[model samples]
Target: MATEREIFSNSGPLDLTAVDWTNSQHRRTVAASLVQGTYSMEHDRQQKLQGHLALGPPWWEFFNFQPVQVLVDEHDLSIFGAIFKFKFPPSYGNYLPQNPPQYVVAFRGTITKTDTKKQDLKLDFQFIRNRLHQSTRVHLAMQAVQNMVSIAGAANIWLAGHSLGSAIALVAGKNMVKMGCFIETYLFNPPFTSVPIERVKNEKLKHGIRFTTSVIKAGVAIALNSQHQRSQKDHSFNILSGWIPYLFVNPSDPICSEYIGYFEHREKMMEVGIGNIARLATQNSLGNLILGATGKDSEPPHLIPSAYLTINVSPTQDLKQAHGIQQWWKQNINCQFKLHQYR
Candidate 1:
């Protein structure tokens, strides 16, 4: 185990493009980097559970199963993973708004049942929680970042994951905050749609907890909430709209479009007459299962057609029915918007 300074000196000038992140050298480099800051590693160790910090065969096995390559520099860290995007139209016109190109970090990982065939529901619950508890993906990520900082300097970091990777990224972001590291996270179609309000609040309280951004195009949020509503708080579980923005992009279908509109206006509509009546009526009839429930089982409201116009790329014939909205409202409402064709 080398100190951070030693590793930095030995590695020479850091070239993110040169490092084969999918190889074992990358892991070793990251591990060494993390151990460099005496205080940082100590802090991470203290915050992590006993078994949670172990970076042994079991931990390495997970990443080996699915390898994702990442590129990091002083300005940003970008991931190249199993995730890729293809647009409908061929070109993303120059007129579209664009955000600063942030570094993308990609991870290839899997989450699986540690145990199966347990008939006792209680036992199953414990098993599942324990499996989730022992995951070391984020810990490894933190280490890699430490290495990056050692070679380069402090940089804005963003984590992106598709499915299971998204959930892992969320967990990793929370763990990083506990370790006193701040990084922004972006998740696309994450498998778990909602998080416990208490957890959400605690994460929000962390000094470095910038935001947990999410993008889910369809009814995934509703379906996930419907299933896990019992464990979440309504108001506490609002979309990660604070510094982190959750964008919901919907294509034009009347019902889908209306649902989007309802999401965009539900909060304000709740303040008026007929809209309030309609909201309450829908809530009662559906067991308060629609988007705006404020209890454990409530769903975050969706952003519809009008909301889409506000956030989406300038409309084209191809975007006839699309709309979008952010989940939280605490951040400055400035996002560079762009349209890309994925076909």
Candidate 2:
């Protein structure tokens, strides 16, 4: 109650351009727990963000971000995302961090197949870009990013996503960098593309990908999501230097199961649970969907041969182990190994 009252007394909800979750050590610790595929701890972290917690590993004094504004549609909560700004806590300048933190934009992924409109939007984002956000609350978040650049001169930014969100991050990264901002994007289990990876590089963006441990195990065939079965790469596999794409794969993911070695060190080994397992199953269901949801002829463009994976084991158990956000935090980030360096 006190927390709510204090928030109400504030000038406004947290501003998106000022708070940086990336700089919070405590936040990173909680994210690491999620990477280990623990959703309970992740929920606690979310509650902390909501200011419902009385105490935790650290106080708000060291907090790196605030609620700011979450972009969501009034009618449907599923079709929404959020934008968070970086806030320098007290003593922040005393202990100068290595790099200046930037704003983070997180696009939520699809969890259920019940919402047909939301499902169509994901398809459009993947297959066509006639209109994204479609006057939805995301426009407000995009406007905030514009203010961060044109108004605040904060050029550094980080883009992140999961499942369908990863696909969205790619587009956002492309647009932001073209705006002349240095953008670093992290994609957790982005869908595969038979279209030469080089083709996307022509668009000029540096990004990273993460997957499950089972996907990396021997004998699992890999495949990308296919929105339009007709869409394919005009050229063969041609590696390009301009776009640096790092892939992180763990165990048992239906979408990103195996790494065919796009590049050395591009793929990293990682380590997940029921909430996570449930999510993995949900992601698997994506395969049979989109086609039905959007009334398209085919499922979202899954690459030939893959985005294809040869699953020898029970899909439930296999998909249970997913390469989503949690493993990315545990292995690629907040880990003693610091495997990201290799990428």
Candidate 3:
């Protein structure tokens, strides 16, 4: 964790003109287009874009990947380039029952590409820190929220994203709640490469905000350790747990059980519930055998029943084929053990 003073002193002024903004824009355009095209193909639909790039049909359709439409039309006031909103259907079963239709919005304008040439010249530290970029993303998200509220009416909102998007979502959600809006956020695999880990630690000390974030343990060890620093702080905005729930469904490796146990120890530090889906897999493979909790003190307090109405696919069965532990939980764990699979 770098101090604000250290970041400012060590990171010198940036020469924006020295870096080819035009080339950067071209690279960004290409990247964004590829993402848009890939998603459009998966959805089996085309969205009109103000840009000139035209994408082909879904390439991953054979993989059974569902296309989620995240509006990216810069020409429309209803949508914008910086903000992307995608609605996941109830059929997805990730949402809680009785909750309003949930939408996840990604604030995408915060990433700043460094001027490598200036670094070679020893003159790349005067302009702005990467956190400033995150701050800009926060501003853009606030504007988007104001616009969304006008058109969509009041609804439950969830924030999610990877990398820079994840960091922006965390900061934006915090600001949104300060404005009296109820927002819950989920961060997926954010890295601590650019921002100072200590700033994130300090921000989590604020009160009166409701934000829940999940990060892959391996993906954010440094950030996780920073969050752990303020574990005992009694603030509404602070992260209740040092580490979020650990998903343990990697059957290929023999030491996976040990890894799960390691994360479970950290989870216990925060007093958050530990979701054990491992036993459920065994029960599903063994012909409807009821697996009881290993002990009376188990967090969930019961074995995940085989008769649990899993949406369309067996949640436990899906875990067996999961490539990563995170995917297993996202696909198998419903709001409260109710598994729903997309068709």
Candidate 4:
């Protein structure tokens, strides 16, 4: 476990007096910090469950957020998420944006501690199996976000999570998008759950394999479409194409690095005069295609049509460091962001 200082040294205390809600950097740091606070909430719960005093102020204390609702897993009874209300001091007096979201629903990733490890690991497994949306945790998360959107309205609600929790956030946000409710979302180190071909040593071989795979997938989708009519979900995905969520990923994290390639490959396809093939390929995956053929409605959680993809280019020592949520708020990290809109 990292010390509090080690995790937050770069983030420091957020300056509420000067924070501009519209600024990208301010928004990313704040969202990442809130997710860290959700992580702290579970840690605080465990310490109290074992009858020990929790040390240090809440990680989100500097960000002026209060957890209004804590999401506990129904079956495992472990803390996994929270809904935080922003406290805008009156003294600040109209400095921030007039319509900034008042609440942020944030979720924390896998906690390996004895108390929460079982449930956290279970959710991680569900994520890898692409059954995370069917899990009780995701159901709870979706309901929580839905309730918040009802109360705060879509424009006044933000969603954020890390790792396994980010997958939860992604699915929930996708559901909301399907319902025509688009909430501002931030996902840090969200797992891609595909082959880690992004780590291949040969660039030419990597591009060759990906391009070939794209063409095959595209062909299969077209053949399947002719045999069976497209489902309503397939049509609804067009709406999803317009809702761009912010994705923060590290290039070295195998769990999320594929996203860097996912978007880049589409652009590469365009350059090679095969953009049409990638257009369909990028939308539907092999898993979803098989599911569709069998008449099961399956949407690939990681296959969003658009995103503000922020790639952390900083070198990391290992996958653990690269995948950790703390890296996002760290100072001096090199990050490059591009908007990938798949048409």
Candidate 5:
């Protein structure tokens, strides 16, 4: 695992204006740096911004982006995210792609520090309960995203977050998609609220368990069909089928590894002539179904309809390294990628 110092340069000013955004490595490194900036702002806000007088400029500046606004948690007054605007215009040159993002909204994961731990963990708990969208932080994030989308078109904006922050971004991005807006998104080690069944070593046992679970979810969905029509959120998934967000996961990271099996198992179900059942099961979690039946609005945070899944196959020493946002910026790591589109 690379240290924070190794992953981020602190020696002197670095320039990335000429870097090719078309390259995946460049994009990943830049996105990770922006996310790291949120952490810096929360802990060491004053020093890092002091240009050459200090050790060096903040990491986001190294990539020719400036923080336009800092997203603060209303309850704790702690910074959790930032909106970055590229220094150059989209029409700058051919170096960047035609539809390069003019603005990026990057969010940091849980910060277990003395100052921010309580609020961060509270949001994490809300995530586990499928209630993150009801939190003030998430609502603020969604509002920030919406304002940015209105100013810069959705095609010119991007969303990136890690761990719990990724869950916030997912909810905001999903809402934007429901409104017929599709923004490019990047998620790193986003927590999936489910049994860590992806860690089961025995393939036969794993497949059997997942198959049974899918059948149960499908049966519940069927039972609820007559009593309750699909929620507006559920119906929006049909529109979300094509807006593919990029998910970065490590097999060793229990917090996010289930994404690998989530998509792969859906393919297996399709091959077995149970595609329709799995489709309904994948979108409607049992918790959401029960809550919806009780006239409560609930949506599963990790029930993404489609994504471009990137799995880090590299070895890690511990869970910290496995789930750390630093892993995404490392160069030459072994990674496997697949685009999972749900019909």
Candidate 6:
């Protein structure tokens, strides 16, 4: 962990792009509150089989993120696998009017269940195909965010989620983009949208670039960013409209590494010409024969968009705490933000 006065870096020589340190720290701090809400959901469940909480008073004091509110009210959100949702101040942009505070929404990841966590991951993949709303859990989250935005008339409604929650955030953010809503996302150890490549039944048939119709559009936007100042507004899908994403991941964590790193891998490959060739060659049915090939783990047509700062960490300092939010904070508390050459 790097101190406030120090720069955050990796053990290796990866030249990292930095983010706005104060704002980055604030997002992590907000993420911490949402993390606590997850634990409270679990304990409250054990006691009375409850599903949501208000997270007020003393707890919000610790983070000093005041005037907080939890949307969805007394209604239980567990059936949708959206265990918890919280409202806090946005890290970017200002409100149209000062009456309502500019706000952001954070979602709690899946609770232990075949239905909640596992199920949402399957639905998350459809995000690129333009099919995210098909999932009930995701649809519910989207509605909640939309409703919150409507009530607050939030100039910008930022979304953050962990694990499956992060995936939901990505999908919902995409939908928000389509609506031309102002938004930003922070994903904590977000999972990739596809299963392992080895698991594909007919590997030979599916080989080549995993570029989905939409994923290709996103890839091109990223390749351009590697060389120019194209903002999200310039991207075809509106992915680069204002700012790129703020991503936090453990490099070796299987959920994100073996699975989710696909989006990251695709960006790197395309920046080097794999995407261009994949786009050009595929025009020939036979040229498509060469197959651009998906990441060792990513899906083609990577639609989640780009990252302003992809903060890679090794918080598995204690193996037991590898994916734990506490570990994530313990590692990120001493944080820094900078501009590195785009990866």
Error of 5 at 301 (Å): 1.6
Q: How do the residues 280-313 of candidate 3 rate in per-residue lDDT, one tens digit apiece?
A: 1211111111111122111110111111121112
Over the stretch 1-343, how does candidate 4's per-residue lDDT look in tens digits? 5455333444454443356677788788888878887777777776663322442234565667777889998777777898998888776787665555699999989988898888888878877656789998888998888899889799999999999889999999999998989989999999886888899989999998898888888888888786334455456667898899999999889999899889999988888797778777787777778877887746788789889999999989988889987777665789998999866
Higher-ranked by TM-score: 1 or 5: 5
TM-score for each prediction?
0.30, 0.47, 0.33, 0.91, 0.90, 0.57
Cα error of candidate 4 at position 75, Å: 1.5
Best by TM-score: 4
Rank list by lDDT:
5, 4, 6, 2, 1, 3
Candidate 1 structure lDDT: 0.30
- Error at 1, model 5, angstroms: 19
The whole-model lDDT of each prediction reads 0.30, 0.37, 0.29, 0.81, 0.82, 0.46
Model 2: which ten-residue window has the lowest total lDDT? 233-242
TM-score of 2: 0.47
In terms of lDDT, the poorest run of 10 residues in model 6 is 5-14
Question: Clashes in each model (backbone N, CA, C under 3 Å)?
Answer: 23, 42, 8, 0, 0, 23
- lDDT per residue as tens, model 6, 1-343: 1222111121211121222234555456455444444444433443453223322222233333343444331233443322232333354346322222245566656455533445444555554343445666666778777887787554545577777667777777766766767565666766643344423446444344344532554455444334333332334433433435666655445555433334444554567777554332222122121232221222222233445445445435643244544434443343334222222
Better of 1 and 5 by lDDT: 5
Least accurate 10 contiguous residues by lDDT in model 5: 48-57
Worst 10 residues of 4 by lDDT: 49-58
Model 1: weakest 10-residue lDDT segment is 321-330
**Model 5: residues >4 Å from true position, as ranges?**
1-7, 10-18, 46-57, 89-98, 227-234
Model 3 regions more than 4 Å off: 1-53, 56-104, 107-134, 150-154, 192-233, 236-266, 270-343
In candidate 1, stretches whose alpha carbon ends up further than 4 angstroms from where it belongs are 1-103, 109-133, 146-155, 177-182, 193-242, 245-343
lDDT of 1 by residue, 1-343 (tens): 3233222333322432233444423322322222122112222333442354422212212222211333221211212122111122224355332321123343422212222122123322322332332434445555655554344333444454433344445555544544555454443323322222222235335212211111121133444455344234322222222223222222232212222223433443344543423232222213224323444332222211111121322342432222111111112323233221111
**Candidate 1 structure, TM-score to reference:** 0.30
